[model samples]
Target chain A: MEILALFGDFTVRTVAIGAALVGAVAGVLGSFALLRQQSLLGDTLSHAALPGICLGFLIAGSRRLEPILAGALVTGAAAALLVLLLTRTTRIKSDAALGVSLSLFFAFGTVLLTYVQRHAGAAQAGLDAFLFGQAAALVPRDLVVLAVVGGGSLLVVALGWKELKITTFDADFARSLGRPVVLIEFLLTVLIALAVVIGLQLVGVILMVALVIAPAAAARQWARRLEGMVVLAAVFGATSGVVGALVSASIRGLSTGPVIVLVASAIVVASLLLAPERGALWQLAHAFAQRRSLRAHRVLVDLYRLAQDHDDLDYASEQGMLDTYFGRRTGHVLRRLERRGLVSRAHHMPEEGTHWVLTVDGRQQARELIRPFGERDTTLDGATQ
Target chain B: MTGLQGWLDQPGVTIVLVGALVGVAASLLGAFLVLRRESMLSDAISHSVLIGIVLAYLITGALDTPLHVVGAALAGLLTVWLTDVLVRSRRVKSDAAIGLVFPALFAVAVLLINVYARDVHLDTDAVLLGEIGFAWLDVVRVGPLEVARSLVTMLVITLVNLAFVVFLYKELKLATFDGMLATALGFRPGLVGYALLALVSVTAVGAFDAVGAILFVAFVIVPPTAAYLVTDRLWRMLVLGCVVAVGSSIGGYALAVAYDVSIGGAMASATGAFLLLALIVGKHGIVARALRRRAPRPPPVVHVPEAGGAP
Candidate 1:
């Protein structure tokens, strides 16, 4: 009831809805950005948008969102293009280019912003708020801008999935198919700028980078196909947004962006460790179990070989001999094999140590295993002979 | 008498010195970072160092303590370590891992700041955009002369970084250009890289109160990057990067004074101005390359002596 009561607040509802839209759109676009290895571009573009925001404000002579966002998109595209140009033409590597563009454009913007603050009198208010955005500033009217841009970008992605997918996974292949690789790249960069600017008012620039990256990275762990990844990422992003919005609203006066970023990062952390097949923890466990079974299987085969060498079906090999043969302790491996009914422990004499002998079932299993190696390495007989 | 004392006494002198010192320190380490293609690491380290500063402050209940820089160094190393873990796990790519780790640390730091903000005067805005205008207000007496504490701090950091660069020049050059060879030769390039980033972290923390994190990142990356475009030699790059930084500091201060804007911000922007200049004039620059491309290509000539063997 308390949670429901909180959501009933108009401001909270609007902010939550807006944040969800921002998350979903960014998730879809960020997948391609990640695959392109241009994840840092989001950071560059977002920071680079500051000057455009200032210029737009100056031109419009108002605190209107449309011109400001327009200006942001323009500079964002320019920064992206500049990065591409530096990488293509000069020896400037992408990371250096990114750092270069990010600092320069942000520096330019900061300079412009301070300049605006001094000259524009009181009219130039709330601009500094963009540095760390106030999510509570989200009004009902602004959600329309988010929805139109977010929905339009989503629509474009749906309609051009084939071209986008080909270009994303393999640009040269797409170029071979006569698709305009350069144009598609430009379009995607623009879409990314769109995704970044959509939530600039709610999340700010620094946190926007995290939003674009975290959800998609988490989705990568679970999804096998591009479509599935896109959908899953969107879901993850939306969930982070809504949860963060609620949590921040519940705790009075806390900004929502960092909270949202923490939630998204939390999701990524969980997905990395706990996802079924691709998860680190799951793979670690799988590898551990596989190694254990492999050791046990090796011990089983060694016993069978010993029996065959001695020309006795029930030939016993001392554990010490087996240990030296394997060059390690085999007590645990022998015990495990025995537990599996693959081997049996015996004593030849009181003065001698415990010995291992293959059981009937173990011999049969060993024969099954040995048969594969024999078949696969049949050429080995010819080579040896 | 407009001698050194009078000039130094002006607020402008302190601002430029503070900016220039921070710039020199950052550019020294940033050259290697740029060459290794880990330039973005500065961005990540600067953000994550906030946690260290906040933790140190929380423990000590004061700002500008030596523990803050130590804590920041540890935090910087922690970010690199965590990013390495994520990459090694094969769960996430390196960039994503970096993106994930730093933001998580930054978010936690911000939340801590917000939660404990009432008890302390640690304003986030001030931390984000430092007040270099007030640098001369708080002065520490060094002998008969009183100096701004930030200037002394930046001076020490600059010297430390300079010593690191000078002492380990060969090691850094080898590691930056050929990491595997360095590792094979038992140089432990990875350790050197971490030590380098740790100092970067310490410098970023030290510079935080003067230029803030964003501008610190600017100083760390931009000047060296500008120098990279202009020079082929490593030593030239180091000197050129410092020159770019000092120039930006002086020029930006003048611009800031002229327009009445943020002095630090203008200084950072001035690096871009110099980079743009480098782009047009450097040997490997855009203009030179374009001019060459526009010129006619020469015919491929075959040497008579080697032609028979080649055929």
Candidate 2:
């Protein structure tokens, strides 16, 4: 009932819905950005948007969201183009290009921000909130803008899904298919700029890249197909935004953007560790299983070799010798094999302790395991002889 | 000489000197980073070091101690380590790995600041765009002399960086060009790479208080990249990068004074402006290429083979 009442509150509804819209849009667009290896482009664009925001405020002389976003879009696009131009025209690689643009544009924005703060009146009071966003300041009008931009970007993605996919995965092939590869790339860049602009109000400039990247990255871990990735990313993004907003609202002094980013990051960490197939934990488990099976196979082969050398059906190898062969793991492996009826342990004199011999089934399994290494086995036999 | 000494004694002079020292130290290590294609790692380190600073402050209960620097350096290393772990998983590409790790750590730092240090003046804005103009106010006495604390720290860091580069020149060069060969020769290129980043993190921490994180990245990457375009030799690149860093510092200060803007921001913008100029007019610049194309080609040699004709 408390949660329902909180959701019904006008201010909370606006902030929550606004954050969710930004999150979903950023996530959807971020999938393409991540796939293209332009994950840091979001960082560059967000930082690049600061000067534009300042410029917008300077020109409009107000804190209106429209002019601010328009300015942000222009500068964000310019920054992206600048990065591309630098990398292409000069010897500078992409990483250096990105770092240069990110810092330079942000620094320029800082200068502009300081200038605004000193020169402008109290009307520009909340302008600095764009640095580390104040989502609590969101009004219903902001949500309308978010809806238009978010819906428009999503529509563009849906319309150009094929072109974007081919262009992203294989640009040369896209070119061979006579697709307008350059045009498609430009469109994608513009879309990314739009996404960054939409997100600036909620996630802030500094933490906006996290909103664009973390959700998509987390989703990528769980999904195989592009469609699935996109859907999952959108869901994850929306969930983080809503949850982060609620938590921030409930908490006394927490800011919303960092909280949102942290929530998204939490999702990413969880997905990386716990997602089904590509998760790190899954990979570790798979490797562990493979290692165990390989070790068991090795033990079986050793037992079979001992039985062959003696040419005795019930010949038993000393536990001491097996211990030397398998190191400290000999007892564990032999016990497991005995349980499986692949090997039988014989109780010997008190001084001799334990011994093991492979059953007929174990000998057959060992031969089958070595069958894949047929050529190598003859060389091993020669060496042994 | 007396007039120059009087100007030198002013606080502005110390600010510019401190900025220049940061520039020199950052670019010195930055040259290697640019060549190694890990320039963005500097970006990652500068941002994530906030956690280290906050942690150090929390533990030591003071913000000004050397422990902050050490903590930041360790956090920077941790950032690299975490990124490496993510990359090794093969689930995340390196760029995405970088994007993933820093924000998480940075957000944590921000949250901590909001919760615990609300009353303290540890403004996040200050961390982003540090006020180098106020750097002169914090003075420390060394013997009978009073020097700007940031300047002293930067000077020490610059010397340490200079020593590191000077001593490990051959090893770093070999490791950078061919890690396998370096390892075959027992140079342990991996260890050298880590040591270089350690120094970079320390340099970042030292510069962060004076120039802020964004400008620190500009200092670390832009000058070295500009130098890279203008030169072919690593040693020359290092020298040119240092020269560019210092020039940008002075130029940035002049611009800041003229515009009455943030000094650190102006400094970083100056670095960007330098990079743009180098990109246009350097040996391998676009303008140079265009000019070369426009220049009349030498007439095809119509050598009169008099001796051959006679034969």
Candidate 3:
């Protein structure tokens, strides 16, 4: 009931929906950026938007969303283009080029922001919020602007999905197939700039990269295909946005952007540890299971060799002898085999330890293992000799 | 001589001197970083060092102290270590690994500032774009001489960085160009790399209170990058980067005064301008490429060549 009431609140609803839209768009677009290894490009674009936001206010002379977003788009695109130009024309690599553009543009923006604050009256009060977003300041109209821009970019991504995939995975092949790879890449850059601009008011400049990257990175761990990755990223992004907004709204003095970033980072941490196939935890468990099975197989083969050396097929092998063959793991393996009824352990004197003998089932299982490597089985027999 | 001495005595002069010192120190380290292709680590260290600053302040009850520098350096090393751990886990690529570590650390710092140090002067805005104009106000008296605190701090850092680079020039060059060879020769390139980063972190912390983190990055990366474009020799690149850094400091200050804008921002912009200039006129620049393309290519080998070939 409390949660529903919170959602029913107008400011909360607007901020929540707006954040969700921003997250979903950033996530979807971020998949390509992450896969292309342009994760820091999002960082560059978000930082670069500060000047544009200030420029937007300067041109429009008001705090309206449309002109501000337009200004942001212009400058953001310019920053991206400048990064490209620097790398292409100079000896600077992409990382240094990106760092140069990001800091320079942001410093320019900070200068502009300070200028506006000193001269532009109290109306410029909320401009500083772009540094660290003020989601509570989000209005219904702001949501409309976010949805239009964010939704439009999503639609464009969906339409250009094939071109983007081909170009991202193999640009030369795309060119050979006559697919205008450069133009597509430029368009994709524009789309990413648009995503960054839309999210600026919700997530702010500093933390916006987290929103763009964390969800996509998390989703990459779980999803096998690009399509699945994109969808999962969007879902993770929206969930973070909505949850972060609700928590921030309920709490006093907690800012929205950091909370949203922290939540997304949490998702990434969870995914890294828990996701199947690729997660750290799953890999560790898989390795452990493989080791266990290899150990069991080694014990069974050892037993089969012992039976071959003795006159009787069921001759018991002392645990002490097996320990010499298999190390300290011998007792554990024999006990496991006995539990499975593959072998039986006979208790002798406690000082002498136990004796183990293979059952009929164990002999049959060992024979099956040997048949696959029948010719190679001679190697094992020779090693024993 | 009196007039020049008076000009040198002004607070503005102190600010510029401090800025130049910071520029020199950052670019010195940045040249090696750019050569190594680890320029982004500077960005990572700058951001993550915030946690160090806050933690240092929290522990020492003072924002500006040697402990703060130590804390920041440790945090910078932590950022690199965390990035390495994430990459080694093979769960994420190096770029994403970098993206993950710094922001999380930065967010934690921001939150700590918000919750614990709200009453203090540690504003996040100040952290992002420091007021270098006011740097001279914080003067310290030492043995009958008064000096701007930032200027003294930056000078010490600059000298330390210069000494390190001078002493390790051969090892750093070998390690940067070919780590395998450096290691095979028993130089321990990895240790040199870590030491370089440690100095970078200290330089960043020294400059942070004056120029801010992002602008510090501009000083660290942009000048070195511009110098790299202008020259091929490492020694020349180092000297050229320092010149660019100092030039931008003076030029950016003049622009800031003329326009009444943020001085640090203007300085960063000036660095960007220098980079743009280098991109156009440097040996590998677009203009040179265009000129090479348009130069009359020896009028394509004519039928005379074809006749000789036939013979």
Candidate 4:
């Protein structure tokens, strides 16, 4: 096949659909994983899938996607089981458990890979592509396998949604409520393994964890509910997958997994910056505007205090005196209040400098800040002037 | 007699030695990492070290220099620093920070190898998969004896790591178990922690030449974790970790030779087998618990009061 044949419309379509399916399934399951704080478990499961892929190839003596993915599911789930057992039974911490499983299984898989490479000879040419993944290798049959597995995992998630959610947030409470927490936890883990296996061909085992976590992590920025996070994650995952697969297909010598991971990471970056409520930039701007309002409130209250002390409602306090009182410049604060029609700037007669007086609206706001329902709003007093 | 002699000859001794030394060095450092809950940071450092090696080569135009080691160490620290920054930003969770930094750095390294260093020895296979099978081919001489370069490198590292543990035994122990107490006692626990991480990074660079990054992680984590199951004492854990590492190296080499598979990988898999073995047969293992449960207890001596009797 010519290299250009990789870019053929049909091939591109198949690859995109395959990647999207992988991404959506992983994203939905990954939301539960992330919420449960088992996000890194996805990384462990992917690393552990290599030996299974090699074993599957050895058992089938061909590149059949069905056997390959099935093999991945088995070992991946076994790795998760080992991790759970280790953490539950022994003194091993969760992070150590994750690392032990990921590395040992991956190493074991490399052994099988090499064994297959040496013994199977030329027939094993494309097998190592599973290392970094090659989307151009996707045939129509592979796509069918991906869809069946991906769709089945999603269906299981939908049917077991309530149990999964209950276990995720509070396993102890779920157990108290007579839910089979252990069984539910196991089911979720297995489902995550299946999602990871689904993504193995598109993103490969090396970087498949990013697909499992990135979409969910990104979606979490926009969502506060499990349902919304899951849905948004699925969408983000599918979009990144298709875009990455297409880019890899277009570029020569570029593998699919890294491209997809990079794209997914880019989405995470954008979401963290641009998401509405919880976005980093959004929060920063909100804090800044809040600080500005706080300062304006302080200046209004200060002007009110000065007028009352002089026994004149029209008393204008010089900016220099207010700065001395607040121990900082009040020009910017006064100007900001003037923009809001909260204060007016007047010329002090003796000194050629500006003085500030609160308008009627500013006085009312000041009264509320100082004597909120005749009770001090400590919220105003506590802030730095 | 001839079989033993043959096993001792050409590449066999060297391969096992190199694997064992790398395993030993990693486990010595890993005991602290596993205890400190920073095992994943080791994983992150191992992955990002690839970029350091590639960048070092690009600048120095040489592969056989200490610059690669230096570069790898710097890259490992960079991963740690970047993870810290991301977590501190409060936008990314600590776990996600680890997952994000290493893979991105690794991806960039792989892409760089694809674009610029394609013809060099820094291919994806050589860097990630490793070629410990050919370690014997490269030799350096000291005194009248010739040795595999990797073996020498790993030996120095293992001994240095041993020295580190021995010299700062109390400090590491204090920091691992009680950071606040150590801080109050005038031990700069944070500095000690960074020092330990730096050693782990250097050790990773040494082992990277033999077992690759993945297998090195297997060595670093599995043996130490298995040892944790077997013993509660730090000294005992350290020794048991080394024993597991060495045994795996020897056993794994035989398995590889018999099956024609990757030696480093088989060594790593052996460590996992030992962990499973520990899980089943150690003092705290399942069999002991099951036996204890089945064992008959002495009949309970009950102070029985007469029916309807009250004090």
Candidate 5:
């Protein structure tokens, strides 16, 4: 109750909301990134935004969020453009081009940051937090900025929905259909860059890739359709943001980004274990049930063979043999089988030790169970008909 | 002109030399990483080395030495191991696994530095940017000649890398080109992978002081990737990669001096520029071929009846 009350505090409440917005935006955009196999683009754009933020601070000369964010947006877009140019103009592969552009821009940003810190003496003027964000320090203005960026990104993505989806699924097809591939790709890249830049204010550059990759990855396992994937990815992202914010608010000195990543990680683990077909638990259970059915079929086949070879097999006498064959006690199970009317005691045998014989229904059930594993010609179904 | 001569003679020249040497070795190892489509792993390893550096400092009380290399190498290898573990045991995709491991490690390193090593200047800026400018300060004088320690170490690493690639060229090339084929040919692709990973780690460790962890990827990836566009044969690509790396290193230093920019950043940018130029102007450039090739035969004109008209 105390913790809940603490969480309700306005400081915690506002920050949590801001975190959620960031996650939601990232998740929605990240689904597109993952589907297109552009996972590392998140890392590239995040790093690329550093110089923008620095330049924003430099231009504005205050700890204000607006100019810094604007700087980040411009630089982020520029970096994406540079990467595109590299891919189109040069023979460099996308991955290599991404690496080159990312490192170069980021290193330049780091150098600027160092120079600012060293020469300006206003090093702690909210610039350092961009590298690894400090959620505890987020003010209401920061929240407002996050909202604007988040809402703006969402609006753009929503409007470009058809175009973005077409390009992502099949660029060639989109081109063939007269859709402007370059224009749509460029638009999507801008939206992606915007998402990355917004995330910088909350999670920072080092961990923003997690925001982009984890939720989308987790959502992919559960979703069969692309639309479902994007929606679920956003939900997972928002959940991680809220949960991570709560945990951070509860503890002193806990960075919000890492906690958010940890929360996202938890979601990934849960998805891996609980998703319908892809879940580990589902696979394990399926395998175990399969083995059980196989064993049961084997037991029935062996009993039928014994009955065929001899006049009858004593149920009580067979319990000992079943125990030896399967390495377990079978007397209780044998009684259950008798109750199910699948097997019966032989009248010729003594009452204390009853001999058993398969009923007509029991023989049919055994054949059904064993049919899948045997050769086609050996199947009993044709003979039965 | 005087400043240029002076700069060339100063120990800063040693920084460029060391940077170039490290660049060559890193790019050599980077070929396989790029081909295997694990280029980002270099970035992940580079970032995670901060934790290793900090831990090493705590344990050994040394700022930058062979011990630093050991710690960084261990950390890089651990990152690779952790990523693989996450991929195999936890069923996380490779990208997500890489994403998960590095930031966590980096955050721990940053927090540790903030809490314990604040007074000692043990921060990521130091670990990432390194003291390339100060490499001259720790010069080892041998009677008449003075050599930068970083340069000497990088030289040794460069030689080792050259030897490894030359002696095991066939195996390395075959394995990198096609792991399945290498395995079918009775070579353990896994061992080769480990060897390559270890080489990348060591190269990163050796280069950390001069170029730092962040820019190490630029060195490792840009050259080989650029070379890949121009050549098909592995041997030629290797040579071309080394040459491109060395050229970029020189150009980067000159550009940095001219523009008064970050030397490492400038070098990376130069390499990227070189790659772009190679990709565009080379004989196999997409635009060039598109221009040279004639259009295919025009599509057949099919007569279509108007909607709801003749069939």
Candidate 6:
């Protein structure tokens, strides 16, 4: 099969690959994103890209990737600058500054998009596609561009790993050590913007933020170390891309971006439910299993009473009475009791059936579960069951 | 017919009324949006609701007036729900969760619009603009008002939203200020949150046709932001937001008419201008107080004594 034909060669696939690569790289970087508590900055900058993309398209007059990306970079940087300005100039905190900048730039972007749509009709055809992306229109060239940008994003992260980690965990400390805190921060913003632009062609303006944040979030549940989290995030991001692409291929008229989000959501849900110690389901199951074992130990203690009370500690003595006392499930409970050697059936009592009794070890096991319930002396006065 | 005739009968008044109405509604919700620190939620919900509209069309095969609105509500709710799920379960932060959910949903909506919506009477332009001008072109009679059905829809939504905020004021305030305290009091922050989300959904639906989804962010944020400059109390904030919104609406329409520009854009620009003005020139404006107070002068005699000693 032709390599292209086998892949169902289309812009959609190419663009989908671009989207996946963008997601993977961003997810890795986003470990730092989440750690810094600036997860929403992705959303802010992505929206901030709108006006730039519009301006780029307005001047450049084509869907060519490079100019639009440059336009996005300028706007994203401006938005970040405004946020920084807001934080420094006022008593308002970082979140407020972020909120203010996010809304203002996005509003400007909307105005730009609407204005261009109405006025620059011939020059600005297909502009709205950038707003939400036109992944299906991806070409080989677009894929190459994404790969380069995506690779560059990875390189930036790897090269600045020590500096990035230092700044993320403690900017003050890094600054105290006379590190280039401002420069590193600016560099991080540019790299994030680069990730946003790489994703723009496929994931579009609104959802590209999601691509950056989701995998990192899921990876966090599984890893204690930051490096481990970043690696896991990249893996999850790549996997989401693959599954999303396959689903899009299998289904006609299905959009790639939403499917990708759904796939990432699945990964998150799986991690939340299944990851050891932290997962909700695992903890719930562990607690339930512990309770059931405790109850089983209690039932064995009741058998200890039946056999040890009679001093036969054998199957034939008072076996019918023990069965009646233990209820209908007594036979089943008795089997477990015998397995533990808390009870046994004697050869002489084969006709008599099973006898329930506690071995010395079994008696010890019974005491362990009952110990936390308080001693018999403490329980007698309360008279509570 | 009655609704259209009424609207056309007062075309100039209608534009201002529509603009003001959009402003008021957007600003009302904008307060909670700003307070909850989800001001950007407005932007997210408005853009993402296109997914709902397209999905509605796909499911029902008609972008009939009410269905389109309903679809928007559904889509808006879906965006919120997905955001919540991502943030809570995936350990994804709220902003990223919001970012992830809507774009994907919006992309799906746009994709549907691209492939299937062509013959189905769904154009992207109409989706964005929401036929603000055409609202007068079609109408339905309601009791005595003879209002444009769009206005009627918005009015009903506005009233319901007002009622919701009024009744749930205490709960919303408590939750907004201190969610843990609200939970400790057994006031059910979850229920309050649901109510707020529901209000956002309804407002999005109501505003969808009149202002379009993208512009909805302006209304949802601008007024509240401006209001924040003027007041610290929640009720006061809400009042101020509504006032700013209404003022911007009328002012924007007049400006648009004067300049022959897009009414929605003008309205949003006006609101933005008001926010900037409030930030700079309001009572607490940085420039205002800095200019009012001056710093003390340094001692000039000390320098002369040092010079004499050197001589």
DockQ of each: 0.71, 0.74, 0.68, 0.61, 0.29, 0.28
Candidate 4 local lDDT, A17-95, one digit each (tens): 8998988998899888877778789989999999999999999998888889889999998889888877877667899
lDDT ranking, high to low: 2, 3, 1, 4, 5, 6
* Cα lDDT of model 6 by residue, B1-311, tens digit: 66655555685666666767777777777687677777666767887778777777787886555676667777777788878886776455676677666666665676677578766646655555455656654567666555666676777778877887888889888988899999999899877876676567667766667766666677787777767766668898898888888888787778767755556656766777777777787654455446555546555764346554755
Looking at candidate 2 chain A, the ten consecutive residues that score lowest on lDDT are A376-385
Report the C-alpha lDDT of model 2 over A1-385, residue by residue, as the tens digit: 2656789888998988988888898999999999999999999999899999999999999888999999999999888988898888777889998988888888899889888987886777887789878888788988899899889999999999999999999999999999999999999988988988988887789888888889999999999889999999999999889888888887877878889999999999899988997887888899998988888899898777776676565678888888887766588878888889999987656689698877878876887887787734443333453
**What's the TM-score of chain B for every model shown?**
0.95, 0.92, 0.93, 0.91, 0.87, 0.86
Clashing residue pairs, candidate 2? none
Question: Which stretches of candidate 3 lie above 4 Å from their native place?
Answer: A1-5, A346-353, A370-385, B1-9, B297-311
| Retained true contacts (fraction), each candidate | 0.73, 0.85, 0.70, 0.64, 0.39, 0.27
Q: What is the interface RMSD of each candidate, in Å?
A: 1.1, 1.0, 1.2, 1.4, 3.1, 3.5
Instruction: Write candidate 3's Cα lDDT for A1-385 as tens digits.
Output: 2767898888898988998999999899988999989988888999999999999998899899899889888888889998998788666798888888888888899889888987788888788888878788899988889999999999999899999999999999999999999899999999988988998888888888888889999999999999999999999999889888887788766668888888999999999999998888898999999998788878987888877766457777888888887657588877888889899986655778788888878977877777787544433333453
User: Which DockQ-derived CAPRI band holds candidate 3?
Assistant: medium
- lDDT value, residue B309 of candidate 5: 91
CAPRI quality of model 6: acceptable
Runs of candidate 1 with Cα error greater than 4 angstroms are A1-4, A123-125, A302-359, A373-385, B1-5, B118-121, B298-302, B306-311
Candidate 4 residues B18-54, lDDT tens each? 9999999999999999999999888888888988988
TM-score of 1: 0.91
lDDT score of residue B68 within candidate 4: 86
**Relative to the unseen true structure, what is the C-alpha lDDT of residue A260 in candidate 6, on a scale of 0 to 100?**
71
On a 0 to 100 scale, what is the lDDT of residue B181 in model 2?
Answer: 96
Write candidate 2's Cα lDDT for B1-311 as tens digits: 55654664697798799889999999999999988999989988998999999988888888878898888889899999999999988888999999989888988998899898887656788888887898888888776567788988999999999999999999999998899999999889989889888888888888888899878999999999888888889999999999988998899999888888898888888998888788787887778767888999999989777775765
lDDT of 5 by residue, A211-302 (tens): 88889888988998878988899999999888887876787656677678778877877888888888889899999978765665666676
TM-score of 4: 0.91
Where does model 1 sit among the CAPRI classes? Answer: medium
